[model samples]
Target: MLVFLNQRLVVFSTPKCGSTALEQALAPMSDIVLQGDPRIKHCTFHRYKWRLEKFLQIFDDTPMATTALIRHPQDWLGSWYRYRHGSWLDGTPQSTKGLSFDQFVEAYLAEEQPAFAAVGSQARFLTHPKTGETVDFLYRYDAFDEFEGFLEARLERQFDLDRVNTSTEMRLSLSAHLAQRLETCCEGDYALYDSAHAPRPKSRMRAFMQALAS
Candidate 1:
């Protein structure tokens, strides 16, 4: 993620997204600085809250903006699981320790239930702590090409995606039951992605005709 801090362009990095590439792009520039996400603290009550407010203070409201790249939930979950467990889609243990994908998915899906909902609920750049207003201009992890253009236009500089570790391969390739469970569990993320990548009118009409022919 990238943002303008006190008239100097800065990068606010998230864990996965293409922060590595963005960090590389801004390296040569003296004005642009890179800052990692401050929400990684276990103490959300005090340390996290203080860090967030301090981050917000860096922007004095003079045309300040922040950019974040979000990946598909399934892919994100898969990567997180693999990083923790060091295992593939199968149950074979690749790592010394970590929860299985099934276990993570089950707990993630159950987050919608009463007690679990607030457990995983954490704030990001888009979220406002005091006003509860979510900032806009969020980009998709799937559409890196378009996002690159957005960065160039916004920052007035070209950005290269070469240094990033982005892979097109789907990780989990969920089975029927797992897919259904995911769809039900991650409904909100799915809807957001749908709205972001909604088909054009022409494409929609073409798909409609194709469906009719079938």
Candidate 2:
């Protein structure tokens, strides 16, 4: 599960998965940008029109690490729902408006677009490119402490726990209805999630997810 990411990292951020916080954390380390396509907020492809490896190599040449924060599909779906429909009920600014989670998922299923697609998926980005080699490390946001520990040890630096734990709230609670709906709307992703064996609920995964979300 640990593959050395050619020394440079590219975090393939899925929307509303705490990618912003991670970008901020690593931002201080280098001048590189963590976004895939600025014009397309959620697009996986870049303006350069390169495949995975070519895009990856562009960053591999830099002194930066290409990394992104990913979250549990169930949790991420909720977050995406909130962000798209309105801001956090806690008073954060809303980013997008129009469409309920159900509606959006329906659109995604029907249109097969980026925002609607890739739910419950990690394999495409988490796996290797050439030899199908994955990254040196696939840090699970759910395993925050361990992941931070791994980073601290690797970089020989201490990270701020208070800052790291910012905005740690489950946007939506797990519900049977939501799960069933998600399974129906995102069948491919649901299956892929099972195949990937994404981390289950636990304090470790919770902490990691919090770090990435903030």
Best by TM-score: 1
Cα lDDT tens digits, model 1, 1-214, are: 3434543343445455666677677656535343544344122323323454366566563434544556666766665555544334245433314445565666556735322111242233334556544334556667766767776776677756675555333345555687688877666656555544322235778889989999
Candidate 1 structure lDDT: 0.52
Clashes of 1: 0
Worst 10 residues of 2 by lDDT: 40-49
What are the RMSDs of all candidates, in order? 7.5, 7.8
lDDT of 2: 0.48
Q: Enumerate residue pairs that collide in model 1.
A: none
lDDT by residue (33-150, candidate 2, tens digit) is 5454633333342322245446556646544343434555666566655545534533333332454555545544454555433343444444443444444445555666665676
Superposed model 1: Cα runs more than 4 Å off = 6-12, 27-60, 87-100, 110-126, 129-132, 165-171, 197-214
Give the residue spans of candidate 2 off by over 4 A: 1-12, 35-68, 87-100, 111-136, 161-178, 184-214
Q: Quantify all predictions' global Cα lDDT against the true fold.
A: 0.52, 0.48
